[model samples]
Target: MRVTVNGESLELSESTTLLDYLIRRNLNPAVLVVEYNGKILHRDHWSQIQIGDGDTLEILSFVGGG
Candidate 1:
């Protein structure tokens, strides 16, 4: 399956939940917000949402520096 992550195209061997994808990329769910297919998904739904082929995902990670 193919999906776009932050404007980069990637091919995944199998379907996976949003949480799994984040984990695979070494991302911390606690510090990031995800926009799936144009909709901002709540953190509570990340573990249950399945990523499908041709889907678009935008992952924005928070940075704190002051």
Candidate 2:
């Protein structure tokens, strides 16, 4: 399966849950906001949402600064 993340194309072996993907990439879901196919996804649904072929995801991580 293929998906695009932050405008970059990637190949995935199979459909995966959003949380799984984030964890695999060493991302902390608590500090990030995700947009799926143009819609903002709530953090509560990350574990339940499935990412499949051709899906587009825009992940924005929150950074703390002075």
> For model 2, how does the per-residue alpha-carbon lDDT over 8-64 read when each residue is reduced to its tens digit?
999999889999999999999889999999999999999999998999999999999
| Error in Å for residue 14 of model 1 | 0.4
lDDT of 1 by residue, 1-66 (tens): 999999999999999999999999999999999999999999999999999999999999999999
Clashes of 1: 0
Candidate 1's C-alpha runs over 4 A off are none
**What pairs collide in candidate 1?**
none
C-alpha TM-score for every candidate = 0.97, 0.97
Kindly give the stretch of ten consecutive residues in candidate 1 with the minimal lDDT sum.
20-29
